[model samples]
Target: MPFIVTDACIQCKYTDCVSVCPMDCFVEGPNFVVIDPEGCIDCSVCVPQCPVDAIVNAAEVSPQQAEFVELNARLARAPGWRPLTQAKAPMDGHEQWAGVAGKRAHLRLTW
Candidate 1:
């Protein structure tokens, strides 16, 4: 299963995980990051590097955050979302709300 980035990564899109990803499956989101299921090799290399503990294997994602697996895959295919390896400094600041509930509001999927 592919890994997914969770709400904890919002506004703190640390690129450390991006730097460690061997398959370049990670993709830059507006405020966080996502993994391309089609590209990820399940190497688990990017998980430990996340400063906010946002990365998780698709099947292991917490029930509250399980939607992220689909979100990540969908965003990965969306037009204009750039692959992580192709970006020079992909992680950029975006509006983030504290204590946002639900998967959609908490995770910054768009700029």
Candidate 2:
């Protein structure tokens, strides 16, 4: 199974995970990120890179966050999602976007 981006990643979109993804499986969404199960190699590189611990393998994901696995897969196949580079570096620093827990700012508008 592929790595999943949990709700913790909403609005934050830390992007550190995006840089380390070996298969370019991470795709940017309006307010969050999604993993392409079809392309992910399960390298687990993105897991540690996420500052909020939003990236988790399907099997290891908490039950509450489990829906993200399918959400990532579905968004990955959706039209307009762009493929990120796999050879980039881990995102540095703290979470930039605040109040993500209260509102899904990324989902409010189409990107």
Candidate 3:
């Protein structure tokens, strides 16, 4: 039961979860970080570290967020994504987007 990074993480790109993940399984994208399903150990350590509570065990996701389960998998397997093992500041003025919805429309999939 690997965890999934959902919409709350869309534009925030918070690195708190990355810093604590024992497996270093997170992959960084333009405005998000995804958990590589194959590398994740279903550990809950990264859950609480997410400031917006965006990380949820795959089995526990709501219907609206169910897409993220597959999203994380696909993006984790995508090329050009960087591995994030250290914590960093959130995107500039991240506070404005921390909990915004409908952010998927703004997701930068190519970079």
Candidate 4:
């Protein structure tokens, strides 16, 4: 299964995951990133690159964050989605939200 970027990624918006993805499966939004399920190779390289540990192996996704699997896939395939191939500085003030829970509600689904 592919790795799914989840709620912990909401305000953190780190591009570390994008830098190591062999398949270039990641898509970007204004304040978030999602891996395109169809494109991910399941190589698992992107997992450790995430500083917040926000990326979860799809099979291991907990019920609390299960919705994000589809969320990643949906947003990845959304119209006008763009590939984020280069790592940039994460959103400012990322430390404030790194461990914050229930951040799914704050995900910005568009660029």
Candidate 5:
């Protein structure tokens, strides 16, 4: 299964995973990064790069995070989402939001 970026990534927008991704599958949104399922090679290289432990194998996704399987794909195709290939600064106040949960509601679909 492909790796999926869960809601744990909602506001943090950490790009560490992006730099390690061989396929450059990650696409950035306003405040989050998602793996493009189509481009993801299921190599798991990006898994350890996520500080929030947001990246998970699709088969391992918990029920609460099940939506992210489709969410990542959808967001990767969103109008403003663009390839994220390098590690960069996280979103403003990322430290405060890093440990926060239930952040799916905070995801910004538009740039």
Candidate 6:
């Protein structure tokens, strides 16, 4: 199964995971990053790289994180969500948003 980017990454938008993805499957948005299901090689290298522990295996997602399995795929292909291959600064105010729950509502679909 492909790795899924979950709500923990919503407002944080940390790109540390992007730096370790061998397939370069990450797609960037204004406040999130998703793994392209089609491009991800299931390497799991990006998992530990995510400081917020947002990346999870598709088969292992919890009930709350289930939506992200499809969300990651959909967002990766969404218009204006482009491929991200390098590590960059996290979103503004990421420190305060880190570990904050219910961040799905703040997810930005476009850049």
TM-scores of all models? 0.80, 0.78, 0.96, 0.94, 0.97, 0.97
lDDT digits (tens) for residues 1-111 of candidate 5? 899999899888888888888888889989988999999999999898888999999999999999999999898899988888888999999999999999988988896
Q: Write the per-residue lDDT of candidate 1 for residues 11-97, one digit (tens) a residue.
A: 666677887777888888677678899988889888888756788999898888887888888988877778887434424442243
Q: How do these models rank on TM-score, best leading?
A: 5, 6, 3, 4, 1, 2
- Judged by lDDT relative to the true structure, which candidate is superior, 2 or 4? 4
Model 4 misplaced stretches (Cα beyond 4 Å): none
lDDT of 6 by residue, 1-111 (tens): 999999999889899999989999999988999999999889999999989999999999999889999999898889888989999999889999998998988987765
Q: After superposition, how far is residue 105 of candidate 3 from its true place, in Å?
A: 0.9
Show model 6 residue runs off by greater than 4 Å: none
Instruction: Order the candidates by lDDT, highest first.
Output: 6, 5, 3, 4, 1, 2
Clashes of 1: 0
Among all windows of 10 consecutive residues in model 1, the one with the lowest summed lDDT is 90-99
Most lDDT-accurate candidate: 6
lDDT of 4 by residue, 1-111 (tens): 988999888888999888888888898887888999999889999989998888998999999999998989889988767888888898998999998989978887665
C-alpha RMSD of each candidate structure in angstroms? 3.3, 3.7, 0.9, 1.0, 0.7, 0.8
Candidate 5: count of backbone clashes, pairs at least 3 residues apart or interchain: 0
Q: Which stretches of candidate 2 lie over 4 Å from their true place?
A: 86-109
Q: After best superposition, candidate 5 residue 108: deviation in angstroms?
A: 0.7
Winner on TM-score (3 vs 4): 3
Per-residue CA lDDT of candidate 2, range 16-107, in tens?
Answer: 77777767777876666788889888889888987777788898987777677878888887777777665333323224544245333345
Clashes of each: 0, 2, 0, 0, 0, 0
lDDT of 6: 0.91
Q: What are the runs in model 3 whose C-alpha is more than 4 Å off?
A: none
Encode model 3's per-residue lDDT on 1-111: one tens digit a residue. 999899888889998999999999999999888999999999799999998999999999999999999999999988898888999999986899986886777778877
Candidate 3's displacement at residue 38, Å, is 0.6
lDDT of 5: 0.91
